[model samples]
Target: MSWTKKVLRINLTAGTCSPEPLNMEWVEQFLGQRGLATKYLTEEVPPTTDALSPENTMYMITGPLTGTMASTAGRYSVVTKSPLTGAVACSNSGGFFGNEMKCAGWDMVILEGKSPSPVYISINDDKAEILPADEIWGKSVWEADEWLHTKHQDPQLRVAAIGVSGEKGVLYSAIMNDLHRAAGRSGVGTVMGSKNVKAVVIRGSKGVDVQDPKAFFDATNAGKKILAENPVTGEGLPALGTQVLMNVINEMGAMPTNNWKDSVFEGASKISGEAMLEPRDSDGKANLTRNGACFACTIACQRVSTIDPEHFSVQNRDDLHPSYHANSGGLEYEAAWALGSDTGVDDIDALTYAQFVCNEQGLDPISLGSTIAAAMEMYEEGFITKEDTDGIELNFGNAEAMIKCTELVALGEGFGAELGQGSSRFCAKHGHPELSMTVRGQEFPAYDPRGIQGMGLGFATSNRGACHLRGYTVASEVLGIPIKTDPLETEGKAGLQIAFQNATAAFDSAGICIFTSFAWSLEDVAPQLNAACEGEWTPERLGEIGERIWNLERLYNDAAGQGASADKLPPRLTEEAVKTGPAAGKVNGLATMLPEYYAERGWSPEGDVTADTKARLGL
Candidate 1:
């Protein structure tokens, strides 16, 4: 069997840690990571439990392909009820943590109950303990990481931790790992903090083994070859990182700007990936430093960037980490858009500074920046005053305000507290919930739904919340991957969204980066999974597993009270027309698409997975 067939269960309330054999029956059906973890969660925790209560559980899981030589194999997921949306939350992340868990001979770690005092989990191979974490309780992720390494006296320990934002209960707080990558969105880190768990430090020298070594190697090697030869995976991503889409999307007039009041940014070129490579007049250096890779990923699409040393945001801050002075995970497209274009701030240096704060504070930059943008719009429209904003001019394109607000949100002080609650709560508090560019209490990503009809349906139906990664139709709508579809057309989009959503679920559960799907399909993934696990994992079987996992999460959300009513976008998206660009006079066709999408998925018109559908999937 591919699974070490083991799970580590930690009850911080009782201060007890135990290891149990994995359920082979579940493994045979659920696969792993997102799918298998959800099965465990659905079985153990009641769907109606408070997301932040001790009764709720968190699962950090890896798939069978994790820790292997498969392309983009280093991935893990944090699964829990989201404090932000009260929906089933599964935030996938990449770094060294998943590989470490696999190397430690465990497929998953289940955290239950609350710790009375601050604590951190330290796993050294088979030994796991909840150690006192008082020293790093209120520190930033960077600070906590350093303290953990010093306390452990091990340079190789991989640490995933929260920061001040999480400790302060920022509704979109993220769980940051490797100092940069994160299980970002839906307040997973807030839930972690509510449990008084500060960090998870792990070290493992052991490696993972699969069911069929030779077949595994062969399958993984072939998958890698496919990725290496694909244009999007091998060339575009490596050359420009995710930010490559900035200019393209902007040119298409689909880049959401100024809290979605506009569909295009006036300064898009200034913040595009191409702009990052241009030498700045200030120091004759480009903003982009280099590209990076997660553990074992041959395709290094991660951007490593540096703000101008003399920029106003970092000027005279000599005490900053050396990595900040140089380069780290830079502005991916989503971050750049949300923190840059969405806020009407095209200053790349300023956006980079905000990105750095998100990494350090463990906040979802998308939610944080989008909420701030909404506040900016509110301020400009006289809906809010200086008294509400602590005298800061919360105006669009105010780079200084953007930088200051990011710092305040990182510390969860002043207006930042309101912004920390996320756009849904922030906008509702000010009597302008319609202004919030969100769906199901989660902020929208870069794409303007009016410009890309498929994404509108995808965002509306996403199980967790409005998110791009849930079902990225931009690949087909914009990049012409697999097939080209008219971005403005509502027809055929229902089947498209369902297909993308199901395929993405499979990738998310497989312990590999979904970016690999730019080239590799389920057919490519099936061989590796079959070689690693004891099962007849064909491409068709993988597709079915994906559908089953999607239905399971939908059921959990339905029971959690986020039912069909939540499958919707804000009124602004459906009523307000895009005033300019190619999508001018166009509004999100959600009304026309939702019913069609439900029909295509075998879900009821109310968006519930039908009993017949469940029986068909054996869920």
Candidate 2:
């Protein structure tokens, strides 16, 4: 069967691990991964419950296709209430871990209640245990991972672990797996830390089987062929990875620079994908070692890169980890924009070092770097002094200052403790809330909404704060994946955003990479699922499931006080205009779009799901 048909429930308070039957009914409705996990969360955890309390429940779930022969089927999601945003948090990650979980005969691992002391979960097929983590309790993710492998004497053990920043309660801490891949948003790791979970180590030998082996083989082969022929998936992504977006986004005037004070960065080309390929002066080698891939991923878009040894950031730093000396997960577009352009730093090596620190210490670089940008703005505006930043001059373009901030925040020490609260709270505390550049207390991503209008609407209503991954209208507006649309126009974008959002939800639920959508639509995805699982999965059915999942998450956030009133952007985006580039003299017209979006979603004017709509979805 495609379904493992088993759920592992780990109660830390009782120090017990029990197997529960998979709810087939919920699986049919929600599909898997994000949707199914959220359903379990809604049933077990209350939205009003304190996110850091023992009451909160965390679910690590995989999709039906995970660990199978399907391409890019290695995705997993961590679902829980976010301590950072006070809303639903579902951070997706890709690595060997999801495949391991599925192979270990589990579809989901649900953690309930808090442990009295630091502990790690060790899973070996059907056997599971919670063991003391006193030795690795205060270690970084990399350090803990090393310790686990050494102690277990199993180099293949897949580990998802938090770092010292997480243990210290950094609001944007992430869970790093396979050394570099991360569930890197909405403070999922902070919640893990609060529950005293230091790490999850798993190894599996039982392989996944689909409903029909011959049909599954045909379906997967066809899917992989589509990826191979598509330019975005086959050539562009594999050649330069997500770093390809740095220059393209900057050229489009959608790159948010200096905390959204401007929409263009002069250093865009200097820190772009092309730059990563240029030979370094010291060793005559490029930063990128090669392209890598997740389990069964044919695209091979994951970047493996290293910092230049002679670069100022790491040249004399004995504090740097040995892995930094070698190759690791490199700067993607989001990390580059946040740490490089948004903060006014052009040094690629410095950005690389900062990204390494993020993976090493389990911090969300997007939130961390964006928070630093806000601090830089506040420092320049005389809102904060050097004394406030522990005597570090935090002016924009100060690479040393940015690196210092990264190191401090990695440990959650000194002034880093304040920065760990995230940009929205940090800016508000410094008497400059308007400069935060956020929606729902989460920092905005690479694309500036002023240039790409639909993103503003997507960011405003995202269930998990100001995240771009939730809807990603950029495919249509900027890349024109399926069809070309005017980036500046507000007309018809309401329907466009809804289409992308619902479709994305389906892709995320199906245990696949959303990047596949660059070429494949739901029409392409339906056949794969239908062949693998025992179901009649059509594009229309998947679309309905996606809509239902969106409404369900919306209801949860509504009850958590992040209701329709919270669906909005910072005044800077709505009130101030873009100062330069193609979108100069323009501000985001979110007000003109939200009403239309609500109507398209069959929701009330206030953005609440109507009773009739709920009944239609059978919610």
Candidate 3:
């Protein structure tokens, strides 16, 4: 069997750790990672339990393919009930940590109950312990990582930890790992903080094994070749990172700018992937230093970028690590758009600074910056004044304010406390919920759903609130991956969203980066899975597994009281049309597409999974 077939259960309240065999029956039904974690959470924790209470459970899980040489197999998920949306939260991450967990001879780590004091979980092969984390309790992820490495005296140990934002109960706080990668979104980190758990460190040298080694190697090699040859996966992503989409989406007029007030940013190219490669006049060095990759990844799309030494964000900050002065993970399209364009701050270095702060402090830059942008708009409209902003000019295009707000939010300071609640709550608290451009209390990402119609449905119906990676129809709509669809039309979006959503769920559960899906589909994935595991894994079965995971999450959300009714876009998305763009006259046609989406999903018009459908899926 490919499975280690073991789970590590840690009870922080009791200060005890135990090992148990995984429920193989549930594994067969739910697959792994997001799916399996949800199954565990649903069975162990009540849906009605407060998301931050001791009763809520946090599951860190890896899929069957994790730790293997298969491309992008180093993925893991943090699954729990979300304080932000009051729904099932499953945030997936990619780094060295997931593979490390698998190499530690376990499939998952289930953390339950609250610790009386802050502690960090440490695992070395089969030995596991919860250590006092007094020194690093209030530290940033970067600080905690450094401390853990120095104290453990293990340079290879992988660490995943929350920052002060998480410790302070920031609703959109993320669990950051390997420095820049994050289990980002839905307040999973907040739940970790609530448990008084500061970090998880793993050092495992034991390698993963497959059922059929020869066949597994062949299949993975073939899949990698496909990724290496495809334009989006090969040329575009590796060359430009996701920042390649900055200019493309902006040209298509789908870029959400100035708090979604416009569908275009005039300065898009200045902060684009192409621009990152251009030499700056000050030092004659490009922003992007090089592209990096995770373990066993053939497609190296990660950006390593450097800020100008004289730039305001980095100036007079010698306490900052040398890596800040050199190069680290740079801005991707989403970060650039959310932190730069959306806030009307076109300064690339400022966005990079904000992104670095997010990575260091374990905050979701998308939600944090977008919420700040909403606050800025409210400030400009006189809905909120300088008094409300603590005398800071919370205005669009204010790079200083943007940087200040980012630091404040990261550290969970004064005005940051109010901003920590996220845009929906922040806006609602200030009497203008409509100004918050979000769906289900989660902030919207870079894409304007109005321009990309399929993404509209994807965002509104996403299981973990508004998230792009959940569906990401942009591959089909914008990049023409698999098949091209007219982005401005809603005609076939329902089926398209369902197709993408299901496929994405499978990708998430399989412990591979979804970025691999840019080139490889289930057809490519089935072979690797089939060769590695015990069962006959086919494309059809993978599709069903994806659907099963989707329905499972929906079932959990329904029981949590965030039913089909909660699957909705904010009023702005439905009522406000894109005033200027290729999709000039379009507002989201969610009304027309939603029922069609339900019918296509084999669910009721109200979005409930029907009995017949449940029976069909063995749910």
Model 3 misplacement above 4 A = none
Across 38-130, the per-residue lDDT of candidate 3 in tens digits comes to 989888988899999999999999998999999999999999999988889999988899999999999999999999999999999999999
lDDT of 1 at 119: 97
Error of 2 at 404 (Å): 0.7
Provide the global lDDT of candidate 2 against the true structure.
Answer: 0.92
- Write down the lDDT of every candidate, Cα atoms only: 0.90, 0.92, 0.90
Best of the candidates, TM-score: 2
Residues 78-146, candidate 1: write the lDDT tens digits. Answer: 999999998889999998899988898888988999999999999999999999999899899999999
Better of 2 and 3 by lDDT: 2
Residue 487, model 2: Cα distance from true site in angstroms: 0.5
Candidate 2: which stretches are off by over 4 Å? none
The C-alpha stretches of model 1 lying farther than 4 A from their native spots are: none
